[model samples]
Target: MQQVKAVVARAKGQPVEVTTINVPDPGPGEAVVKIQACGVCHTDLHYREGGINADFPFLLGHEASGVVEAVGDDVTSVAPGDFVVLNWRAVCGQCRACERGEPQYCFATHNATQKMTLAEGDDAGTELSPALGIGAFAEKTLVAAGQCTKVDPSARPAAVGLLGCGVMAGIGAAINTGAVGRGRSVAVIGCGGVGVAAIAGSALAGASPIIAVDIDAGKLETAKALGATHTVDSSTTDPVEAIKEICAQTYAGAEGADVVIEAVGRPETWKQAFYARDLAGTVVLVGVPTPDMTVPELPLIDVFGRGGALKSSWYGDCLPSRDFPMLVDLYQQGRLDLDAFVTEEIGIDDVEAAFAKMHDGGVLRSVVIL
Candidate 1:
């Protein structure tokens, strides 16, 4: 075991602490990663707030990139010195989903069998519940070997680390779940990190008339720079009508965009997405809704009449092993502006400050450099 400095949320709605934790050496099928960079994601904040569960003293942070420091005897997919992105979905190849060659939907994803524990304080020796099974806001962390996806070493850790979560979720929402492609008209509701990533993905896929919907004008401007062909200030304009009007102008008689991504995870925005898609078009919900929030009521006849799919995206339905390397290459080629997603780089101790800045419209991501 080794002691390392890490950020921990000891209780619900309490300030996070930077303290020492004990990370066990890799066991069978596990690996130890020396974290280089980790992005501060909203989910980490959710975990800290007890919004995810009652798992207190949670080791927070998940979106991360690192170098393999050690591996168990059975580990082979990655090795010491390899640059990698950490992922929560470490697929079990024996699962039914993997058996059918759809490991992205693997039913038995896993984490390290061993636990990291609090090394000091009144809570000493208490095992921590890692956020999304990847407690990466630390100098080092232990995870299942499969959680480490090797990528190009030259890629910037601060930029590519985001692929471990939000950026990948957004891109995958469009490219994987929504099946957006060339000539498809796409509209994304919400201009947060994930929403803008959807716009970037749609642009990467050659989607036309990419409409960005947001209440914040600054976020909308960022969306346009990322690939949104048009912008809708939902605070001032009706997004559904604006998206439909834009798509109709490009594709004659079109009622709305071919694909509408609901990234806000709110009832109102989801309703807008539901009604803002063309006939038989898709509605992909990538945003996470709280447990108390129920699906908005709509007519059963509308569901039957829509003739399109309403899907919830789980981690963008991404297979990290396949997608991570490809995305890194794209970033290296300058085709994907992964760097733009990183708003600032901060020390591990500044996590709470970074969390405070999350509501700032100008900040897309605050990355922690270990």
Candidate 2:
């Protein structure tokens, strides 16, 4: 067993604590990773607030980049010393989703079979539920071998690690799910990390007249740097009307954009996305919603009248094997400004503080560097 420092949420609605935990040796299909850096994602906060589930003391951290330190004898996909990013979707090839050739929607993902427990405390023997199958806010973590996606070692850990979750979801929303292309008019609502990343993805795909909508001017400014052609302060302006007016310039007579991405998980914003797109346009919802939240009732005829796709993007429908390395290379070449996502580099002890900053919108991403 290996003793490591990890962040844990001991109870619902409580702050996370950094404590010592026990990590077991790799078993069949498992590996141990020495975490280099991990991004503080909103999902981690959700897990702590009991928004995910009631499993506590939960180990909270997922968007991470690390180096493989050991591997089980049966693991052939990755070995020790490989630089990698941890992904929650470790596809089980036998699942129906994989059998049908869409591993991206794999119904069964892999996780460590053995549990990691508290090292020394009243809860010393308690098994901790790792958030999103990866408790990465630690010095080292144990995970399924397939969870490790090998990438170029030269890539900066703090920036590349964001690709493991939120960034990937945003980028995927525009590229994979929305299928944004050259000269396509696109609008992204709610310009947080995910929203800004969506703008970046749209730019990378060569989308023109990219409109970014958000209440915060700071985030909108960041979006512009990332490649947004215009910004809308949604708090004062009607985003739907703004999007339609801006996109109309591209279409000459059209009323809306070819694609509208909703990165904020709220029923109201969803309604905006639904009405903000041009006829036969796509609407991709990448933001997560709470169970209590329900879609506001809309006419069935309107749904049929839309005549386009309305889809939810799960982790951007990304296949890590195809995306991680390529995005990293883009970042390395200075084409993609992944580094701009990192607003600050914090230590493990400051995760709670980072969480506060995220809640207040004071930073884009506060990475925990080990």
Candidate 3:
């Protein structure tokens, strides 16, 4: 075991602390990673607020990139000195989803079998529940060997680390789940990190008339920089109408976009996405909702009349092994502006301040460089 400085959320609604924790050496099928960069995401904030569960003293931060330091006797996929992006979905290939050649939808994902523990103060020896099983806001962390996906070493760690979560979800929502393609019309509702990423992915895929909808004008501007052809301020205007008008202009006689992505995870916005797609279009929901939230009521006849698919995206339905390296290469080639998502670089001790800045419209991501 080794002690390292890490960020820990000891109780709900309390400030996070930078303290020491014990990371055990890799066991069978596990590996130890020396974290280089980790992004501050809303999900970490959710874990701090007890929104994920009652698992207090949670080790936060998941979107991370690192170098392999050590591996168990059975490990081979990655090795010491390899640069990697850590992922939560370490697939078990024997699962039914994998058997069907869809490991992206693998029902059984896993993390390290051994636990990291609090190494000091009153909470000494307490086992920590890692956020998404990746507790990466630290100098080092142990995880399942499969969680580490090898990527180009030359890629910037701060930029590519985001692929472990939100960015991947947004891009996947477009390219994979929505099947956005050349000349397709697309509308994205949100303009947050994930929403803007969807816009970028659509642009990369040659989608036309990419409409960005958000309440904040600043976020909409960021969306445009990332690839949105048009912007909609939904707080003052009707997004559905705007999307329809925009798509109709691009594709003759089209009622709306070919694909509508709901990235806000709100009922009203989701409703807008539901109605903002053309006939036989696709609606992909990549935003996460709270437990108390229920599905919005809509006419069953409307669902029948839509003649399209309504799908929820889980981690953008991505397979890290296949997608991470490809994306890193794209980033290296300057085709993907992965760096734009990083608003600022901060120290591990500044996580609380970063969390406070999460609501700022100008800030897309605050990355912690360890």
lDDT tens string, model 3, 1-370?
Answer: 9999999999999999999999999999999999999999999999999999988889999999999999999998999999999999999999999999999999999899999999999869999999999999999999999999999998999999999999999999999999999989999999899999999999999999899999999999999999999999999999999999999888888988999999999888888998999998999999888888877898999889988899999999999999999999999999999999999999999999998898676689999999
Worst 10 residues of 2 by lDDT: 247-256
Model 2 accuracy (lDDT, Cα): 0.93
User: Cα deviation of 131 in candidate 3 (Å)?
Assistant: 0.8
lDDT of 2 by residue, 169-238 (tens): 9999999999999979999998999999999999999998899999999999999999999999999999
Model 3 spans > 4 angstroms off? none
Model 3 per-residue lDDT at 35: 99
Give the TM-score of each candidate: 0.99, 0.99, 0.99
The deviation in Å at residue 286 for candidate 3 is 0.6
On lDDT, the stronger of 1 and 2 is 1
Q: Positional deviation of 188 in candidate 1, in angstroms?
A: 0.2
